[model samples]
Target: MKEYSVVPNKDVTGWMVKIEDVAPEKLYDERDAAIAEAEEIAQKNKPSRVIIMDQNHEVEEERTY
Candidate 1:
C-alpha cells in the first residue's frame, strides 16, 4: 500500500491531496470536491492549511553494527 499526503490551501478554503505513486490524472474536479468538503467540515473554524504527510516518506532507523 502506498501513502498519500493531503495539504489544504493557504486560504483555508480547500485542500490538496497528493500521492507519490499515484498521480492524479485530473485534479481540477477533485480539487473542487475536496475544497467543498473541507469548507463544510471546517465551518467557522477553517484551517489555514492542512498538511498530510505520506507515511511512505517515514524512514526506518538503521542500527550500525
Candidate 2:
C-alpha cells in the first residue's frame, strides 16, 4: 500500500501533502485543506493511506483508502 502525509511546510507558512512515489509536494494554506488534498491523492492511488501530522511533524491521524 502507498502512503501520503499531510505535514507542515517548513519553508513557508502553510501545510503540505506529499505522496510516497510522487515528487514536488503540494502546498496548502490550511491544515484541513492539506488533509483533504492528501485524501484526494490517496483516493487516486486507491490502496493507499493518508497520514496527518501535527505542527511539530508528529503523526496525529491516519486514514486508509
Candidate 3:
C-alpha cells in the first residue's frame, strides 16, 4: 500500500506532502492546508493512507483511504 505524509519541512519553514520517504510533492505554509492536500491525494490513490505529523515532527493522527 502507498502512504502519503503531511510533515514539517526540513527547515521548519512550512509543511509538505510526501509519498512514503520520497521527496515532497508540495509545500504549504499552514498545517491544515498540507493535511487537506494529503487527504485528497490519499483518497485518489485508495488502499493508501495519510500520516499527519505535529510541529515536533511526531505522528499526530492517521487516516486511511
Candidate 4:
C-alpha cells in the first residue's frame, strides 16, 4: 500500500492540496514537485473546496482503560 502526506496553505482560504509521500530520494523529490504543481493549479482554478486524502498507516498506541 502507498501513502500520501498532504499540507494545505496556512490561510485556508484557497483551494490547494499538497500531496507527498515517504520514499526513495527520487520519489520524494517527485512528490515535492507534484505538490507545487497542484498548488499552482488550485490557485488558478479557485475551486469552492480543496480536499487532501492520505492513506492511514500509522498505528495508534492504546491507553489504559
Best candidate, lDDT: 3
lDDT of 4 by residue, 1-65 (tens): 12223332334223233323333222223334644544454455544222343333232221111
For candidate 1, list the clashing residue pairs, or say none.
none
lDDT of all the models against the reference? 0.37, 0.84, 0.91, 0.33
Cα error, residue 62 of model 3, in Å, equals 0.7
Give per-model TM-scores.
0.29, 0.85, 0.92, 0.32
The residue-by-residue lDDT of candidate 3 on 1-65, one tens digit each, is 89999999878889999999699998899989999999998889899999999888899999998
Clashes of each: 0, 0, 0, 0
Per-residue CA lDDT of model 1 for 1-65, tens digit only, reads 23333444455444455443255312323444644443443343333332232224332221111
Between 2 and 3, whose TM-score is larger? 3
Worst lDDT 10-window in candidate 4: 56-65
Residue 26 in candidate 4, Cα distance off native in Å: 16
Task: For candidate 1, give the lDDT.
Answer: 0.37
Q: Is candidate 1 or candidate 2 better by TM-score?
A: 2
Identify the runs in model 3 with alpha carbons over 4 angstroms from their true place.
Answer: none
After superposition, candidate 2 runs with Cα above 4 Å error: none
